[model samples]
Target: MSVLNTAEIMEILPHRHPFLLIDTVEELESGVRAVAKKAVSFHEPYFAGHFPGNPVMPGVLIIEALAQTGAVAILSQPEWKGKTAYFAGINHAKFKQKVVPGDVLTLETEIIKVKGPIGIGKATAYVDGKIACIAELTFAIG
Candidate 1:
């Protein structure tokens, strides 16, 4: 149910393996909103250091996934093509549940405000329709 797969996402965002957290983009509205997915697997390299026995997907990575989702929305636009979205700040970030291997993270980011190269997005990450994390992310196009 994805509009853009990994191959397509790579073309828009300058990201690659080990760091590239998004798997598929399900919905996109140019610069308005986006929904993306990340399949968390036990084989992910981050699991080794995140925890020795009880592995939990890092909250920061979840936020990064949301950022990538936002990037997909912005970068898909005609005027923003090839531009990089840099993380400016994060506000009101809250983690409600722990995300583990075998979980599919559905990340959604909506543009809440925009002005020139700077903007803010409201983002949320969910697992099985349950909220995992929520935050307001600020970014700058470079």
Candidate 2:
């Protein structure tokens, strides 16, 4: 189930609906790693313009969800509480499969390195135990 619900996640990360992709945080290790979930629904606004009938969740949003999961890991720390994590860079991003409506997207992000306000995370998104995307994300805490 969810360790942190959408409301609780909002307290740590300054993200709101439509943009706030993660529905719940299943696992979290302060400043180290996090695993979150997003239920892809046909009702999502992006499905309209993204495609008329063949609705597919954008690859960029998948990466953003991964970054948001990483932000939860970083922002949950006492020292970093209330801070915002901004994307500094995204490297080695690979999309392996399409994410569509009714899919349960599982996101995991592990903080691999941190120096001052900058951190790097190894992130992955999976659907039904198969990897959908993977990337190395760099973030700046401010």
Candidate 3:
């Protein structure tokens, strides 16, 4: 496991504070694939209003986490460093389960195809070995 701590991840991604979702990277293949983790906590800001009593991690945030994981893999390359990956689009996104506090979400993303500044990645988020969300993410390097 080539673990990247929060500091390393912050270096690769521009997100911060309540926006940066990924906690640690367990695997990375520079522009190829990556596996990361996000320890969901009840104290997360969104839980305060996402639902008053039954707080649930938003599905869109799961996709964002996946995208960030992919960015770590893509931007880690010497040629792509310092570049930002924008959310071009999302396809076939599906939510299989609700993610709540105390769940450690394992996020995996693999770059399936790329062309110039455009790229495609297949992403999935899992909790307790069960699939929580899956999607085909499209991004553009900026």
Candidate 4:
């Protein structure tokens, strides 16, 4: 129901530059579902060696971005604030498209289940309205 800019996102997530992938949260429903965005640029340090002539965003980093977005969703819940969300597991992860510089990634996360300190979520990354990656990510509040 609200939008969270990078400043607000920093309050919930501990990630810093080169690791903090999300730029803005566009939609949120507390514990249910959320949508965020990240703008990939050539200025990112990782683009230097990710490839020489051809630069592609790393798949593992894509998953981490999705996980971070999911963490933001979980942390937005009143009871989960001020806690750290740690990646516990990842399942059925698939990378369907290559992410390059100048791409605006739309990240979506839906809570599948939440029990005590553990939470499971389904996450997907989209570019130009098409899915680029997807996975089931589990997190533990610490």
Candidate 5:
């Protein structure tokens, strides 16, 4: 069990500013599970047009953040380290609540199965202890 900081996250994930949605990983257990966070802010570029008067974090981006967290869990493994994880598919995605600026989204991912370069996981996004989004994501490591 270990906590990974932004520096460590950058080493594993290829995402950068305006796209690197994960702020910090608070918990990690190799291939088993992981938890991370993304602090939503009004300064985000997307907020500008997402709705000028009433900005809201886009649902797709929320799912992407969750998938990115799952990627961290998969890539953190020694054998998968340095590899890139691509979004293979998403299923059973649902947005239960709206995520807005000032929300600290807690992203949780648990590995459901993994075989070779293919991995499947379940992810959930929470804000203020309430689930905002949930999905079953599949990824392919290359």
Candidate 6:
């Protein structure tokens, strides 16, 4: 089911509960790409204030989830181990669908370019095969 569990993902990425959006990594290709999943639940903290009657998973968090997936891809490299990947930029982001509680997001990020400590990944988040969000994420490792 999971190529890398949450515990294993923690070893590669510096993130924790409430903020760690990804549940499990379904596929990994070292520094090239990664596919992860996140199960959205109404019990999430933000749901309390994100809109009383209507709960919607924020688009920003979806992007962050995508970024985390990309981080896993970049940080998995031996040279980048123990390094933190900071967001340099986010470009061409689009939210096509609303992700709500009970939706399981399938996030994928493919490293498209890398130069020195900076890299760019093409990311996409999907819910039940439908695109929820897409973006080009840039990261700077330090």
Q: Point out where model 4 deviates above 4 Å.
A: none
- Going through the candidates in order, what is the number of backbone clashes in each? 0, 0, 1, 0, 0, 0
Cα lDDT of model 1 by residue, 1-142, tens digit: 7899999999999999999999999999999999999999999998999998999999999999999999999889989999999999999999999999999999999998999989999999999999999999999999
Candidate 3 weakest ten by summed lDDT: 1-10
Off by over 4 Å in 6: none
State the displacement of the C-alpha of residue 101, model 3, in Å, after optimal TM-score superposition.
0.4
Indicate the TM-score of model 2. Answer: 0.99
For candidate 6, lDDT tens digit of each residue in 6-94? 99999999999989999999999999999999999999999998888999999999999999999999999999999999999999999
Stretches > 4 Å off in candidate 2: none
Local distance difference test values of all predictions, in order = 0.95, 0.97, 0.96, 0.92, 0.92, 0.96
lDDT for each residue of candidate 4 in 46-119, tens digit (9 for 90 to 100): 88999978999999989998998998889988888899999999999999999999999999999999999998
The global Cα lDDT (0 to 1) of model 3 is: 0.96
Ordered from best to worst lDDT, the candidate numbers read: 2, 6, 3, 1, 5, 4
Clash pairs (backbone) in predicted model 3: 31-73
C-alpha positional error of residue 110 in candidate 3 after TM-score superposition, expressed in Å: 0.3
Report the C-alpha displacement of residue 58, candidate 3, in angstroms. 0.5
Candidate 3 lands at a TM-score of 0.98
lDDT measured at residue 42 in model 3 versus the true structure, 0 to 100: 98
Q: Pick the candidate with the highest lDDT.
A: 2
State residue 87's C-alpha deviation in candidate 4, in Å.
0.6
Candidate 4 colliding pairs: none
Cα deviation in Å at residue 122, candidate 1? 0.4
